[model samples]
Target chain A: MLADGLRRALTLLLRGDPEVLGIAALSIRVALVATLLACLIGVPIGFAIGTTRFRGRRTALTVLNTMLAFPTVLVGLLVWLLLARSGPLGGLGLLYTWWAIVLAEIVLAAPIAAALTAAAVQGIDPRVRRTALTLGAPAWRVHWVVAREVRFALLSAVVVSFGRVLAEVGAAMIVGGNIRHQTRTLTTAVALATSQGDFSLAIALGLVLLALALTVNVLLHMLQGRGDAGAA
Target chain B: MLALRDVTHEYLGRVVADIPALDLPAGTTTALVGPNGSGKSTVLRLLAAVEAPSRGVLELHGRAVRSSAERLHARRAVTLVEQHPLLFDMTVAANLTDALRLRGARRVDGRQISEALELVGAGSLAARPARALSGGEAQRVAIARALLLAPQVLLLDEPLSAADRAAREALGNVLAALRDRGTVVCLSSHVLEEAYRWSSRIFTLVDGRLEGMTPENLFRVDLPPGTGSREVRVGPLRFSIVTDRSGPAIIAVPPEDILVSRTPLDSSALNQFPGRLTAISEDGHGRIRLAVDVGVELITRITPASLSRLELQVGTGVVLSFKAVAVRVF
Candidate 1:
């Protein structure tokens, strides 16, 4: 049965089945948008929190670190309640739509980005900032020097966050509804297929998901290697 | 001139530097000579405007800087190379280019970057990555990065505290060039005689207090009106003076000027004292510092060879002699 499922999955992939390609494309697209939004909102927040000294910063970091380990299903359940009918945001009626799934993944990815970025910024040497200040750099330019010094680590944070959100199914399944040919992501389709005892399509979708995760990990290692070289 | 008036700074609620008045004039290479923890680096930071004074003013060209904008302007006019300088994560050439860009250079000239690196004998390391540099190479590159800005004042903290003989000679050439170029260089050093070779204006600091302008051996003397002899009593000894002012005065005998001998010699050179060597310590840079008491405490630095030749120890009684002309009154 496994061999037959694998052979059938490869054939479907090679034939470019519209259903399979559409699901894969939607998965990549939704996750890409979510990851970009997370980075846009989280990098600056993390940099500020990491560099500045203020009251309650320790509490903020503690909350952020806790959010990094929050269950994905819990994030999905919270989004479900917020988007459910008669909920606070129910007026928008975004439940079980592409936007709903994107929002869920965004909620999932942002904290990862923020927490890792803060760690990266904190790991750098303060002398780099002082040296730039002495070189006639204005405050903003000094900030740029610090960011540039840790650019590799920042990229690693982005990749790590992207990897986390891409592999997560609970949030997308709860918020996207797995609608046929519209919101059916690879993971949701695999779940739907496996429940009906269709192992071929489920295995095919699992293979695709595994390949993508492998790619993300490889990219992460490559980025870390370059960062170490630059810091050497 | 770059001036600091009533500028005092505190670190973590403890006073680290207190400068009543300091004037680092253009065309002068001033040296802040002191031992460890003497607040030399703190004074340099205040002069560079990188650290605001706890209660005082920093003046650029005789105008007091009052606001943040003016403080930034003051910082732009001066550049400081920290004692342990950190280079940006880039090639040597790129670091200089970034500094030029930081100073608002719209068009970064490659020739100018190369020239700055070459100025500090670091031209060969222009293409080398910053992380790959040795200690001396990194020091040279950091200084080169600062020199690229060509600010009116260049403050260096402990520039010679870590260099070897060859690096020292090369850095000496760089300092000599800056002196002739009239860039208003101010640096700190434990070795005073080396500072004298660069500039005459020296500010000595001891325990965070400005002890007039000498590396060591500063004495507050009372110059009472006397007969025809040009001499003043300090402690249990008398020293000849060149200045005619006859009131309380501060006198400094440069450490290099005093010659140590086993016994008093019959020579034309005038002032001499018999004293016991109280302490002996090494500055970790091939120089020995000695403290002696001839009814008053005095400090001097000499080489290892001289120490070995004189056979000096903690309790040895020796004679200290210097010409009357060597005593500086402030």
Candidate 2:
């Protein structure tokens, strides 16, 4: 039975089974969109909090750090509460839709991006700003130079957020409702397949995830090599 | 001209710098000579207008640099090179190009960048990555980057602290040329003679207060073991000091503290050296300066009346005397 399942998994992937290909495409597109949104909302906040000094800055950072370990199911519940028919934001009727799942994934991963971005900016050499300023750079240019200095760390924030989004199952299952062809992601499909004892499909989706992770790693390695060439 | 008026900066609730009316006029090199924690760097930062003063105003050409608009002008007019300047993670030429762009250069010519590099003795380093250079090489590039700006006021915190001989010579000449072009160059150093070599005016900062330590007759002395005897030997002469420090130290004998006489003094001035005068010139302060080769060269300031009374001339025998307390040991 195990050998038969392995052959079926390879056939599903090699022959590009329509269902498996659709699941993988939806998973990547959702994760990329959610990661982009998270970065857009988080990078500026992180950079500002990391570089400037003000009251309540530490409190804000503490809150971000706390959310780095946030439970994804809890994030799904929050999204459900907001998007459900009886909830405050339910007027748009987005519950059980892919948008609801994207919202859940964003809540799950935005904190990771934010906290890591703040850490990245703070890890930079403190003299970068002073050096840029001394060279007659304007305030905006100084901030740009500082951001450029930690671009690799910033990219790490995005990559980690994307990873979190791709690997999350509870949020996708809770809000996405595991509907086939519309909101079912690779993670949710794997969960459904295993529960129904469809070992071939489960193994096929798992292999796809592993391949995706490997591709991300290879790309990250190449970018890091370029970054090191630009830095020490 | 850059001036600080009633400027006081506090760090960690402690008043670290307090200056009431300090002026850095263009067309000269002024050195702030001091040790660590003396607030020289703080003063330089304020002068650069990059760091705002806690109280009072930083003025440029009699206008206050308080608002952001004025601050932009102040920053463009004055620039600072820190004790350990930072270089961007890029090629030397790229760094200089960025600096030139920030300097408001309409056309950032590649030739201009390399010429600035050549001025600071880093011409060959243009193609090299900044992180690959040695400490001295990095510093030369940093100075070149700053010099390319051509600001009216240039502040440097220990600009030559990590420089080599060739780098030092190149920077000195460039700074001299900048001064000639009416740039106000302010540099800080712990070495008084090195300050004298680079600056025409020296302001000594001690515990965050400025005292004019005339950059003359300062010498580095070595005290061997059992140095508690308060005596140091340099070359062929034994000098008396009032410090408990043993090993390498610096001592300064103020020119005005030395008394010149024709005969040996029977009084309590402990250090008396007999030597012939080498040169006589104006002290620039309504007095005359006499250089006497007393084992080590000693500079003495005397009034014209006293000079005539002693009939001192070049190559005449004279006795220079100062008390042990006159020697400042650091």
Candidate 3:
């Protein structure tokens, strides 16, 4: 039975099944949007925290680092409450929409982006900051120079956050409602297909998801290797 | 002039640097000579506006540099090159040009970049990746980057630490050129001879305190009570200084007045010691400074020809003679 399902899965994937394509496309779109938003909101905050010294900075950093390991289901529960009917944001009616899934993913991905970015920024040699400042670079320019110097690490943060958002299931299922053809992502579809005893569809979606992750990671690795070589 | 008034900097409630007063005049090179942990780099950073003193004020041209605006303005004119300068992850030319571009230079000509690099003897490294360059090469590029700005006050911390002998000499000449161009150049070095040779004035720091400023051999000696002349003993060696001051006093002997001979000299000079040559080093200007130890180490400068004429080597026996009048007691 497993062999038969595997065979049927490959055939469906090769035949360009519309439902499978739509789920995969939605997964990519949602993950990309969440990752982009996370980066936009996280990079600057991380950079500031990484470079500056102030009262409460240690506590702030500790909090951010702890957020990197936060459970996605908790994030989904929190976000779900915020957007659910009769919840504070019930007026928007976005509970079962793609935006709700993106929001949940963002809540899940932003901390990873922030924490990794902070680590990358802090990993830069302190001499780089001193040299730039001594050369009359203003504070903002110093940060910019440091960011460029650690671009490889920053790129890794983005890739890692994207992968996290793409692979996440609990948050998307809870907030997105897994509405077929509208908000169903690869991970949610695989879950629904398996529970419904549709082994062929489940196997097909799982293989496509794995392939997408492998391809993205491989491309990022190649880029990072090139960057390292160029730096060397 | 860059002046520090009642400056003290602390880190985590521990005092790191404290200078009651200091005046670094324009158009002169001053060397901050001390050992590690002596707060030399802290002084340079404070002067460069890379950091602010925990107390008191640092002023430039009679204006208090307290505000960020003032510090930013001063930073444009005063740049500090670190002990281990970090080159941006780019071509050496780009590193130099980036500094120029950051300083708001609209048109960065390649010739200007080349000229700056050539001045620091890093011309060949223009096309090379800065991160791939050797330590000495990176230091030279850093100096070139600083020089491109034509800053008014240039502070360097151990600029020659990573340089080879030839590069050290080249950098020394570049510093002289910078001083001649009326830039107030200050550098920190643990090499006393190099500091004495390169600086018009030298500030010695011991345990984060400014000890002295005379360009001479300084010795903390105790003097017995005397009226006109006092016998000062440093280690096992004794020297007479013509001073009315008694008790603990610092004595300085000008290197030029200290004469080295192969044999004991029968002369009117009041001080003489039979010592051995401990080390021979150049003063970056073709002159040699010989480290001789009788009971205490005394440095005497001579020409390279004289060094060879005397057949001096490490551990060679020599006699050092100096007159009491040449000793300045403070």
Candidate achieving the largest TM-score: 2
* CA deviation > 4 Å runs, candidate 3: A223-232, B213-215, B218-330
DockQ of 3: 0.44
Give the fraction of reference interface contacts each candidate recovers.
0.76, 0.57, 0.67
Q: Rank the candidates by lDDT, best first.
A: 3, 2, 1
Q: What's the best-to-worst order under DockQ? A: 2, 1, 3
Q: Estimate, for each residue in B1-330, the C-alpha lDDT of model 2 and write its tens digit.
A: 789999888888888788887888767789998766788999998888878988989999988889887887788888898888878888889888878765566688788788888888889999998888887898888888887887888888987788889878987877877967888999999887779888888887766667565757777788665644367886799987777777776678989899999989997888988999999999788899999999999988999999999999999998989998888875
- DockQ preference between candidates 1 and 2, better one: 2
Candidate 1: which stretches are off by over 4 Å? B63-67, B218-330
**Error in Å for residue A76 of model 2:** 1.2
Clashing residue pairs in candidate 2 are none
State the RMSD for candidate 3: 9.4
lDDT of 2 by residue, A85-117 (tens): 999999988888888888888887878888887
Best by DockQ: 2
Tens digit per residue, CA lDDT, model 1, A16-74 = 88888888899998889889999888888889888888999999899988988888889
Q: Supply DockQ values for each candidate.
A: 0.50, 0.56, 0.44
Q: List the residue pairs that clash in candidate 1.
A: none
- Per lDDT, the best of the predicted structures is 3
DockQ-based CAPRI category assigned to the predicted complex of candidate 3: acceptable
